[model samples]
Target chain A: MAKQIVKALDGAAAVAEAMRQIDPDVVAAYPITPQTAIVQTFSQFVADGLVGTEFIPVESEHAAMSACVGAAAAGGRVMTATAANGLALMWEVVYIAASMRLPIVMSVVNRALSAPLNIHCDHSDSMGARDSGWIQIFSENPQEAYDNTIQAIRIAEHPDVLLPVMSMQDGFITGHGVERVEVLEDQAVKDFIGEYTPKYSLLDIDNPKTFGAWAFYDYYFEFKRQQTEALSKVPKVVEEVGQEYGKLTGRYYGLFDPFEMDDAEIAIVVLSSAAGTARTVVRKLRKEGVKIGLLKPRLYRPFPGKEIVELLKDVKVVGVMDRSIAFGSIEGCGPLYLDICASFFTYGNGKAPKVVDYIFGLGGRDILPEQIEGMVRELIHIAETGEVKQVVGYLGLR
Target chain B: MGELIEIRWHGRGGQGVVTAGEILAEAAMEEGKYFQAFPDYGPERMGAPIRAYTRISDSPIEIHSQITSPDIVIVVDPTLIGLVNVAEGIKEGGVILLNTPASPQEMRQKLGLAGKGVKVFTIDASEIAMKHLGRNIPNTPMLGALIKATNLVSLESVIRLTEERLGAKLREEAVKANIAALKEAYEKVQEG
Candidate 1:
């Protein structure tokens, strides 16, 4: 019930603690930057027999995820982690893991895709796979990385919610920062996140069911329907896990964590670790009597569009922070939300919040709090007079 | 509603810098505090520089995110001395604990810390690790010095975390050797 204090830890350590506490039966890992330390630490736990989890040292990310899929298919409580290019390598099998409905949890540290080839943090990698059937949760800090990782297994294994889940933190940002993160007691975590036995496992040799076999149109439609049906449980499962996690630890994790907008006239929405920087600015600007707030979207993929539109209903101005660049088009991830908000506005007959985009921190550049403050101020300025660029506000670009 | 204490770690790939950050966070969690630790990297390869961070808070933290500036910056490799701008974004009153034999004066000159008011401290952590642990990996030794330089956490905390993190065969020896390495560094550190 008590809290702990440590100097700092990065994203990799947060996931390792979750794995140790869960003590999965198998861990299939392939090395990649940012995500390497996580599997390495767990592999050590496996090597020393500290954990009874079967450690599978696979040769490649494709094989690493394939092994996890096999382990999960076999009904073994399995775990693993990979990022960026390694994830790209495993792209096909990832869909298999989801379609098969194996409740395997993995950590995906967000990294930029290569053209120029950068190792800094960005959303391009994850955004590319947005349509893949995994329940994705983006964490803004180390604490969330730990808690959400633990929650992923719980949410994924729920009989009503048997789909793969991936919790992502910015590669090298939340992934590598050393902050004091609260780790629940092994028993508490185990208690909070119960055993992860799958509903149907490949290990049931007696059951003798065909899996990963080809399905024609006759069975394909139903399977696809079932896949869609499983996804329908995500919102409820999120609510359930957030409730239980809140009961166990006092933190509330959800679709959105809005700040300073109780009665604010203008607001900003942000995601990932960058929200921390935005919050500091919101606090300072709020003290100056600025009517600005922050709407942070934690659940990115299963776009909580209506929920977000409702949250923005009364607000006059909204500034969306995109930690990525869309390049060649004005439509990066942030603009997708604008589309949702716009539809809601159309429903309200042109009575919705005025929307704009603020792209910042591409390639993991440092975005200062004052910059977020300035973005919100500019949004408020636009709201007061209704004159701002359609393509507006890219922070941290000199 | 409670505030959090955020920390960040920076080092190279081969160095145990990320390990040190995780072990420290684990130690604090053992103390029954709300804490989390993690690392940040992109291209996973040897010789590449890396960073790790942690957060300890009094209440539930919904905003799972990355740390920007850290309260304590732990440098485990001397090579990082040139590769990283290590002291950037460290809090005003924060301390920089490095694993080098250079004095605070020599380090300030070499590290170009003439203007910044942040405290600079160092310990021969690699030398200490080589002597005590018989390995070039200086994570534990620098962590020892870090615990000393900034009493952000206790030596017992570090040992507890070390035990939780280290392999059993090496656990006892590691606890003894690394703790000793920390004490050696702590005693040698100055507020210069």
Candidate 2:
């Protein structure tokens, strides 16, 4: 490993640095609050001539993704950034980019979708796109955001999984929060990602291939099946890329990061920035002789259900915290909770832990350490008494 | 985990409170400490009240919530005293630094913090800035006063880091004036 440079940077700036090192052929992006800093920083890099990238300032997130799709189809590496309603705006093309098998990576600074018009951290934006066939990776801090951004490029471009990827960081909380981040040298990053050579290109007139072709009724289902098969290969690619990155940086990653799960009676499952807050409480509780652990999901899409179930099997009571609500779905629980429940149902075979859902931190509400500790205490009560007073709960809620 | 120092900054929208917190965090990192700096983001219009936070420790910081109980509170805009409660959740034996022309005792009386058991320090950072830089930017000078009053980080690192960060966008004379303002505030801060 080359000597790492330590710097104080926010998640947005860190991801921008990663993008700079990758130096893709195209970066077509439209700015939105929280995520605007990312493209703004990258634009500076483009202006300073530090990167050899074609930076296109698009009109909207839809146009941005559309430009990315066009660029990638022409056999060029492309990337973009968006948040909240911007992701909602790109909803149509988001699926197109995935189904077309274009390996365009995006930095999703997660935010809450608006009727209230708030621009802050929440998972509702990405959760709404959970079925869009994009591989989603959640980051807990600026360091993880930097690492995951670099990893997403490899995961999306993998031959076995030519699917779009969304590397996420909580807006304002992680995106704007400045912290110490140790960055790999630019040359090392270049060496790690190497180069991207498309299998077939629209520009290859000699071997002319078609894309976005109409496949109705008979062929549409088969096309979706192929997409599903491609997604199934993501976990393996993610692991391999993570392992390679770890060898270079000494920070190994997996499907999920489990903290003190061994021989614990109770546990909390969460994602993104809140997981860091929950881990602090788990550590304090463990010191007080409370058998509690934390499982933070890193890869949200291609959801690692079987692996998550294996880790939570030994715990008696588990609380899954979600920052985005899946309205009217299974007692109106949050999306992450619903997925965790489905994972337990499909893989646990009647021996899964008693799973509960906690819908928390909606609309960028704060999730304090004390609030997390209270949730843990509730989990302890359920573990000791074997009675879940509440199946679905609200944390940090009025 | 070593002791963590949490600081809260209260200012208006354009007073550079957020940058002050960020610079302190960066300076702490230069001293081989871990730090986090962030602002309470909102629809920030000019002259609107805002707050920012900083946490520095020997180990990595995990908590992502706003600091409820800060060990130090720096008030960059004195007008915020009546508009906002500057000492809502300060810890016992904590310190409160203000950029004001009034002495610390007068500030304690005005804010009704006489018996709060917290240290109060005051520095006329605006005057220092105007004397040196011909402007009223108190954030940089207040940073120097914060270091002198708390010893959070070495003053040398703050100066070097500030010079390096500003040198990219500022002329040499402006950078030197900013440094002069910082040193003046460090020498002139008064404690109650």
Candidate 3:
């Protein structure tokens, strides 16, 4: 195994370091809260000549994605970084980039959307883009952010799954918080990602091709179906790439990471940094002789429905904690909650646990261990009584 | 550091509170310990009150939340004592390190920390920084006091890591002066 060099870095800096190592052909980004450090640090690398990447300081997030699409379609390895409003601004291009099958890797520092103009951590930004056809992966800390960013390149460029990837970390929490991260050697990363050899490139004059070509009735549906088919392959590709990265770095990743779930009667399903807190709570509860556990999803887009159902089917009660709200939905739960419910409803063979939703940490509200403990206690109650008083609940709300 | 040691840093923007946390985290990393450092990022304007946090442990830190009940609180800006509740949610027997010209006893009285079971330490870190660096950036000096109060990491390691982190960006003279400030504050910090 290759030796790992551990350094203290924030999620943004870690992602920037990965980008420096990958040295993608193009990085077009606009500065935004929480995510600004990623481009700022990467641009410093460009100025210092550490990486030979063409850094484009675009005016808007939409323009940034547009530039990325143009570069990626030209057979270049392209990347970008953005947060809440920026991701919202790139709404049109975000879907287009995926539909065009451009392998653009984007770092989405997760932040809350604005009507109140708050710049704090939440899953709303990325969850809003969940149906936009991008492969979404969430990171718990700087280490995962670094590892995911590096692995995302290979996953995006995989021939069987040529799709854009959004590697997400919590805004401010992970983006600004510095932690110990083990970085692989540049040569190892370069070799792992190899090269981006576009099968159909606009730059390849010998084989003429048109990207984002207009398709009416018959072809548009087929193209959409093809995009859906491509998405179906992402889970396998993600796992394969994750295994390869684990072999090199010893930090393995799966669709979802289960902690202390072997004998857990009650579990909490969550994502990103909250999962870290949930794990800590699980340890505490386990010591207290409670069969509590946590399930943290690293891969969000492909949802990993069957795998998640399989994991939770044996549990008595499961609580789904979401950092973003799915407003106006029938259940009035968060996006992740809706997905988990949908998964159980579809694939559960009458062994599905009674799942409840807890919306927590929206707009960067702090979710303390005590709050998690309370949620677990509630889950235990649900398991004991075989009744859920409230299916959708809010945590840490006054 | 078998258990997690959470530290809350209170300072103003541009005072290097965030950088102090980063340098301390780097020193802890050098000691082969797991650590996390982060600022409560807000609309950053110079002189606006800011807060940063650090968590050092022998094992990996799994929780990612604001340090509500800190084991140690380091106040880099003396004026912030009245503006913000610097002692809010401090764990019982927690240590409070302040950069003030006042004596530890006087500071304890002024901050109303008497009989709180909280240990208070004081250092004229701003004066030390001004004497060494000719500026009021008390972050490095406060870091020195933090090491003296908590002994979370060695002073030598912190100075070395400071140089490593700031060497490329700062002038050689500034780096030397900052190191000197750290050493001076380490020796000068007084316990109440």
Candidate 4:
């Protein structure tokens, strides 16, 4: 509700600005391409006395995440950023951070895992960590990147959902692209994400709490069930935090962002930056008298299946676009498509849309508006004919 | 929903092509216009050909992809003209602004775009940079020629933005020289 400041910043810079406002107690980070700017910018803020947070330039992403887990377990608000191989290196600690219930926020600039090396945008990195017990949220542009980064803190630190959260933006596309972002006043952000009050801490010698302790069959299953219960509480907390943030910033968020879906007969579901491109095409198709819409998932983990089914129940044919392929799956479909299939199966009461999978934009390949338009036309044909073509197809593959 | 102008820049890794696009986007922002600017990112190796893109519009831009068909193309490194297809995917009636001492007609012939309904503009940006800034960084001067080719952003806003953004990094005289080169390129750019 305060006066906002407009600045031209890339997704990384916007996130760093949010971090500066959050001013966590500790930021243990290792530099990696695309994500490096976030660490670099935040480090400068630390050096310049703009923020009182302790900035640690760790040796590697693994060490960086380990340090975050340690700091967070010690009851200090913690944060970090990395991409691709860096995230892969932190694979072990990522799960530990979540299972240990340490709410450390991280910025994941989504990059393709390397074999034939690439330093470009893709969802493979984050999608690989979908079941890591950490809450995941994706951003479409710098504005969402900033907003989501700020909200990730609240979501992760909520008492009902004491879990780590990774906020994601597409590498090079959103991470490096410059656009206008209306940043909140520093005091407004500080007031919004108030002091981090931990009920128990490693530093609390009087009331000791054992963390990362080995749990055998006697208690392990119970701990896992507890984690599931905690995660089940996230959607409510996310809604409340998002609503409060909306009141402050006038940008309300939900489990997913649906565009023109109320009366649509054909639609597409996507995530992250590609959603922006799909939305553009959906607008064009709507102009041509086609009832098409798009659903962009802002939250990926604890997949909002029932809500998504409700949104797409009326649409005749729906296409699910995935930026990362789920290797060895049905037709080697992308991860998002598999999730959509599961959502429909579990939640659809015989009202499921004719869903198709589109694996696209892997390793930072561009998904143009025309390519999306072609998919929309295909969806129209499928709607009219009542015959599904291939369940999974690669979009714009050479 | 309103008109969107997309511009693509061709240059080497060390030519500040990305910064030039950012500067233009920032200038557009100053005019209360929405814009997106980014490089076709890759491993940054000096002298390796690279591209950057910028889009400006009256409304918000939701699409985040490479600019396939650019309305304006600025070749910051003249040597890249032969090594790269500088005019590929250019729209008809689009403008190609090259930083070369050669005439626009010569560039049109070299690019094989002669009589293709695409306008070509040329300026000795390197010469302008060397004359004023005592350096061969033609990015700023090419921006001036871009303004002459397409009045997407005001010349004054570009100069002011250049001064503000570059002033923090370079000496005051260097910033002034860069502005001078920009003005000269704006005055001397030739269209064919």
Candidate 5:
């Protein structure tokens, strides 16, 4: 095992440290709440000459992503960081960058969307961008944020899966919350990420190629089909890279992490930092002889539907906790619940577990252990009675 | 002292409450213990009341939620005593260390801790800071009080970590004066 260099760093600083080690060719960023520290710290690294990255202090998030697209298409390793509104501003270019197949990596510090204008931890930011053709990975803490960042470069640049990757962590919860993180040596990161050899670069004059070409009816449909086909190849590539990374470090990455779920009669399905709290709840419940467990999805995009269905099929009752609301849906559940329900309906073979939708901790509300214990109790009731009073419920809400 | 010790820090934005938490975390890390320190970020301004948190554990900490209940609560700004519920949700037999000129008995009455079973400790940290550093930055002095009250980590380790963390950014005189304030507060903290 590699000697672990433990340091106290927040998620943003940890990601910045990983970026410093990888030392990508270009980093175009604009400051935003919760995510400002990432760029701020990396820019200092640039100023201190710790990394040879071209740091672009862009005007807006739109311009930031645009610069990333330009640099990435030119065959340079590129990355950026942003939160809620900043991500919304980068919407158009976000899709274009992925469709153009630029292997750019980004750190998305998850935050709530605006209307009343709240800047706190929520899955709304990244959840809104789920269909933007980027591979999304959610992290539970600073360590996972750092690990996911380093792994994302390898996954994005994989020849079979040339797609932009978003490594996400809760905004103020993980992004600004400090934790103990074990960082790998700089050389190990360099060897793992390796050099970016673009398959088709705009800068390669010898084999000049056209990108973002206009496609009409006959070819546009085919192009969309090809994009889906490329996306289908992501799961295998992600797993392979995860296994290799696991070999390098003891920390293993997977589509989803299952905790104490082998024979659990009741379980909670969640993402990001909440999973840690759920695990603590699980331990407490387990000690009291409650067969409860937790399932946390690390890879959100490429949804990993089959894996999730297989993991939860045997459970009697499951609660899907989502940090982002899927407004106007018939079920009125959050996005993660919607996706998990859809997955079970498709692949569960009529053995679908009785799943409930829980909208929790939106707008940075605190989700305490007692609240999780309440959810577990509800799940147990559902398992025994085979009845769910409400299909969707809000946790820790007034 | 137990499996984990969670501490909540209350102070104004510019008082270095966040940096104090970070410095303590660095000291705990130096002791080879797992630690976390972060501020509850808001639309921060110079004197706005701010909260920060720190967790020290023999094993790795898994929970990332806000420290709703803490084993120790450190108040770096004396004005925030009644404005914010500094003693809210403190663990039973927890410690509350305050930077104030008032005696612990006076603080207990002012803060309404008559039967809370929580130990109250106070030190004129601002006076100490003013005497040594010529400023009222009570964070370092309050940290010294924290070490005396909770004994979560060694005073020596905290002072050394403070120097390593603030040495380059602060002048040598400022660093030395802060160390003096830390030592004085450590010795002068009083309990009710």
Candidate 6:
């Protein structure tokens, strides 16, 4: 396969290219900065007659989701992309898209959800929608952004899992990073993932199914139970699809890739774009005889716990860095990982790794390798003599 | 991993520096290599001066975001030196692809370089764009100099991207003149 070289592309174009390969029935999106160019390119695709897809220039991000939900409900494989404030605007109906279980896939170019109004990349937007009944996946690079968009469609529209999925990439990281990405082949993708066969849809007028039924107290719990069961099965489906994708493309997609953990006493868990920075530190430390590993959570909603516990089995220290603030919480993703580690210790009757929470790169701050290396050094010091640094620390604040 | 060429462009808003960066990206994407093109909007915008960056590599890019460290810096405007600190973060082997009519020696002196090992390729790209394109859009012509200076991606590939990415109506003549301007810019480039 010949590689296509691009000098630079804004974040929007990178996403728009992936959408073109998916070739959905309709794409409805509202314009929002950092995200506007993606739809603008789609609109241009519509105008140039380059793609045989209908593009709806909607009034708002909320409308974009509504239109896609309606389109997917009518048996159309639909997708949309939006960023920070736009995702917040679509908050109300986002729950509806998931609860009614429209297999809609969206790209959340992550940005901070505002009180002071920021447009830069932050996990706040997607993190706020954590419990929205959607299978959320975070991508580390443009290649993942491209591959994940297509897979997101396949996963969301799966027969057993007719749920909405929001595929996320950092606003500028994967979005703006101009790197060579092998846009997957359409036939290979189609053969590997099959066509979108939505099990049940409102579009079938012959049968006529009522979606979003007003469940009374007697039946609501069971309906909710079934949805939870359905959501639980997503990780398996994701693994299956990822395996098939790996066979076609040489790059294997793991829910979490443990780098240099084979001989590690400390493991750092990062999400989205910062994983690359962590890996750099991981590589440098390993070469210098430091046993440091990296855990990047691909599927945040499904939270790959058992795999994490198994990977961290021998390690003594675990550092979790979260890019968003869950105010009044333990800070960053540390609390969540802390809970996971605490559970492991409780259940396994084994010592849990000394866990530390880190809050870094919020509102587009830099995640440098030195900072990562410095933390690992601190962890090593703690490992040598059971002393601890501040458990919940924010990186790069002076 | 093949030829990790990073080119940095420095210019103020409305100077078409960012456009030049995009042109380089367009050209490379035409050649079918994994390429990234973006600009740094650092608490900055029109008239405030900013940077547009590019990284061209054969392998899939794992790193994203700003080109904090660059292999080449394209200075579209010279007065930027007196105002903005243009030479902030350049890698060890990196070069400056500037749009100046000065000889390489004169440029080195103007840039306060006498001892440091730096390759400065100077071209009057703004003049070429005006002469050929009948507009002050130095992006195309300057890109020609960029191709000649760094030899990153071919000038032909750039012309192809311009055709593919440009509107259909503007595709034919714009591609032709841009190629010609690119040739002029590439020819005028003096490496030192």
- Per-residue lDDT over A1-398 for candidate 5, one digit per residue giving the tens place of the 0 to 100 score: 66668888999999999999999999999999889999999999999999999999999999999999999999999999999999999999999988888899999999999977999989999999999999999999999999999999999999988999999999888888878899999999999899889888889999999988898886888877777887898988888888888888899888899999998999899999999988999999999999988999999998999989999899999899999898888567899998888999899987788989999998899899999889888888899999999999889999
TM-score of 3: 0.98
TM-score of 5: 0.98
What are the candidates' interface root-mean-square deviations?
5.3, 0.5, 0.7, 0.6, 1.1, 3.3
lDDT of 6 by residue, B65-153 (tens): 46666778888876676576566677666788777777878877777765667787788877898888887666767777877777788
Off by over 4 Å in 1: A1-9, A216-219, A326-350, B1-192
Candidate 2 C-alpha lDDT tens digits along A75-104: 998999999999999999999999999999
Every prediction: chain A TM-score = 0.94, 0.99, 0.99, 0.99, 0.99, 0.93
Identify the superior model by DockQ, candidate 3 or candidate 6: 3
Give a tens-digit lDDT track for model 1, residues B69-168: 6776777778788778887787776678777877887887777776787789888878888888887777777777777776667887786667666655
Real interface contacts reproduced by model 2, as a fraction: 0.82
Number of the candidate with higher TM-score, 1 or 5: 5
Error of 6 at A275 (Å): 1.3
Error of 4 at A192 (Å): 0.5
Clashes of each: 56, 0, 0, 0, 0, 18
- Tens digits of per-residue lDDT, candidate 3, A1-398, equal 78889988899999999999999999999999899999999999999999989999999999999999999999999999999999999999999999999999999999999988999999999999999999999999999999999999999999999999999999989998999999999999999999789899898998998888998996999999999999999999999999989999899888889988888899899999999988988998899899888899999998899999888889999999999888998668898888888898889975688999999998999999999898888898999999899999889999
Model 2 residue pairs with clashes: none
| Share of reference contacts found in each model | 0.40, 0.82, 0.88, 0.82, 0.78, 0.42
Lowest summed lDDT window (length 10), candidate 1 chain A: A1-10
- Model 5 lDDT at residue A252: 86
For model 5, report DockQ.
Answer: 0.79
RMSD of each: 5.2, 1.3, 1.3, 1.3, 1.2, 3.2
Sorted into a CAPRI-style docking class, model 2 comes out as: high
